[model samples]
Target: MNTLSIVIPALNEASNLPAVMGTVPVAELAAAGWRTEVVVVDNASTDDTAAVAHALGARVVHQPERGYGNAYLAGFDVATGDVIATGDADCTYPFDALPDLLRTLVDQDVEFMTTDRLHRTNRRAMKASHFVANHALSALSRTLFRNGLRDSQSGMWIFRRYIWDGLDVRSAGMAFSQEIKNAATTAGYRFMEVPIEYRTRGGEVKLNALPDGMANLRQLFNHRFRRQGGRGEAGIPAQKQRSERYEAV
Candidate 1:
């Protein structure tokens, strides 16, 4: 029975902290032959985010680097589980949906799982350009290298420990999300995507739309136009071949 270490990267999220902590089913987790622990990577939050998480039984690691990727990596380095599950702390991602990711591994024996924000139930605040960007990037990723992720920018993901252990997480900022998918494809790791809703953040979005969007576009083009080796073949080892059959996440 392996443990599950949930890495929650947060930045001044004290308001949402208690709710998230209360939402997770820890007793059920322990009963299922699974030990559960959370590592909250506080990205220089001025509030009591770290203190609150500690009160709720989460180990807080302060990551002064100030980026989603860096905070996630900070939490990952200290994770104790065989599988690392990462998600946002702003309540945009449903912590209740975590079992879906765990079930994916049991049922499919796959290596990675990323959530799709375009799920059926929740309403999306997608601007026209954002929708276009999502589709365009998704299509390009499939066409160019078969990354096969419907939502490259999705914040929720569960990854096998070995796959992450073998590779270096070099992205220090938002673009790192796309960069990981780029790296994953070349590495022959099995990929899966589950649909998760994306609601507007309770507070303002931490993201800067024009700049982040442009950065995403640049990464996409780098994948589309740049030499194939970095994004597609930088550090990959041969693995098992893909099967004809598939399971929907």
Candidate 2:
């Protein structure tokens, strides 16, 4: 059976792990011939994040460094699956939609699949400021990279494990979300976005909208120009292909 590694990065998210982990359709995935390897990266949290994840049947990986990308990279290094899926441990992303998302990934032959949380988002799930920031960043990303991505900051993404080595993602912070997506698209991978239900978070929010948004903006321009100067591609890969279908949930 094929294996799917679900990697979640957590920092003081002990209160939210139960709902996040419980929503994962393990039995449904198993019936579809996919074994789920749930990995929760403990980002040096003071609380019981690691213990909670372990008790909830997740393989806990210790990431002492306190960066979103650092935790995810650490988890990815240890994940033992053919396919990799990523999300946060804050319970904002939809884990119950994974089974159907996995089907879309396979059926469409997509190399990288990211979720869209902005479309039809619940008002209570995200603050107005975040929604606006996301739209602005996504607009800049689409304009700079020509990737046609709607939600560049979405935390949930499903992709083939092998593609990780080829993509050149460098951000170590919140900018990691856009960087990874840009990297995959720039590497000529088949990409698609699916709409998913976003929910109100269960724990304290860690993001500083102004600073993080500014950092992400800088990362975007820097990445685009750096690639253009070094590879002469200008963020647009010659072999890139858009997915035939956009599966909506």
Candidate 3:
């Protein structure tokens, strides 16, 4: 049976880890013909994040460098699954929806599947300013990259592990999410976005909205022009793929 590595990058999220980890439907995924391995990347948290993850039966990989992308890169290196899935350690993303998303990924023959939290995001889950910023960034990304991504900053993504080898994503911070999606689409891989419920987080929010948003804007422009020479080498197979919303059952 193929394995699915659920890699979660956590930074001082000890209070939120349990709720997040508990919702991963390991048995359901197993029943769906995929064995699940939860890999938690401890991003140099001062709290008991590593211990909490371990106690919850997660394999903890310690990443001394503290960045969102650094933690994910570290977790990806240690993940032992053919298929890799990502979600935040904070309880905002729905881990319980993975089995359904995985089924959609395979059935649709998608190489990279990212979730859209912006479509159905509640006011309680995201601030109005942050929501506006997300929309502006996503719009710019679509215009620059010519890909139909609704949420450029969504952290939840599921994709074939081999695709990572071909991607040229280099962002070490919050901009990594947008960069990875852009890389995958630019590489002519099949990509899709599914809608998922965005919940209010359990711990203190870590995003420095203004600075991170500005950095993401810069990264999008930089990445777009950097790959200009090799833009259509493979052609965009993802564009030919559909971008329908996934209605959860």
Candidate 4:
């Protein structure tokens, strides 16, 4: 039986964590041979994010840095599981659909699996500007990395823990979403994507479309042209240096 750690990166998501935690089907997962642990990585939130998460049966990992990438990196370092699952704490990504996704990952034995948020039926869940940017980024990623993934900005993913060892992830912002995929693809990891519903966020929207899009674009180009020869060197851990900056909460 393999362990699964579902890591949710939250920043001031005090109100949203309860619903996210409540809806997770922990018992069902355990019955299906996965000892699931929900980890809420609080990214220096001023609100009661950590306290709320702790009360809700989630182990809260505190990350002082304030980036989507930073929060997840911290969570990954602390996760004690064979497989790592990632979703947003804002409730935009569905927690109910995780069982099927996990089944696919296990059945197919893929190294990397992500969801396609573009198939979402809710028209108002995503903003028009954000949708456009997501498509542009997806196209750019496919062209640059040849990964053939539809959603470059989708936050939901499940991957083998050791797959991180082969990746040289450096993005500490929104760009981390695309950078992880690029690194995984470059390392020839098996990849797959399934459709998942994208809902409206529970709390406030945190994405800055223009700046984040520009940063993702920069990440794509940098990864394409820059020489990444020694980062994921044999025996070295994934994002080793980056993980040192964070302290346990």
Which candidate wins on TM-score?
4
Q: In candidate 4, what are the lDDT values of residues 1-249, reduced to their tens digit?
A: 779999999999999988989879998888888898889998999999999999998988988989999888899988888999999999888888878889899889899998888754755788888887888899999999887898988898899998886677888999989888878877899999888889888878898877888898988999899986555446454465445665654
lDDT of 2: 0.86
Those runs of model 1 whose alpha carbons end farther than 4 Å from true positions after fitting are: 125-132, 223-249
User: How many backbone clashes are present in model 1?
Assistant: 0
Which portions of model 3 miss their true places by more than 4 Å? 227-249
Error of 4 at 208 (Å): 1.2
**lDDT (CA) per prediction:** 0.72, 0.86, 0.86, 0.86
Off by over 4 Å in 2: 227-249
**lDDT digits (tens) for residues 58-166 of candidate 2:** 9998877788887777777777899999999988888888889999999999999998998754666899889989999999999999999999999999999988867
> Could you give candidate 1's per-residue lDDT for residues 1-249 as a string of tens digits?
778998888898999888777767777767666688888888889998888888889988877768877777677767779888877888777777667558776689878877787544544655556666766766766666666677777777888877874553456678777767766766688877778766556554687777887777777667556544322344532121122221101
TM-score of each: 0.83, 0.90, 0.90, 0.94
Better of 1 and 3 by TM-score: 3
Ranked by lDDT, the better of candidates 2 and 3 is 2
**What shift in Å separates residue 145 of candidate 4 from its native position after superposition?**
0.9
Q: Please say which candidate is ahead in TM-score: 1 or 2.
A: 2
Query: How much does each candidate deviate from the true structure in C-alpha RMSD?
Result: 7.9, 7.6, 7.8, 1.7
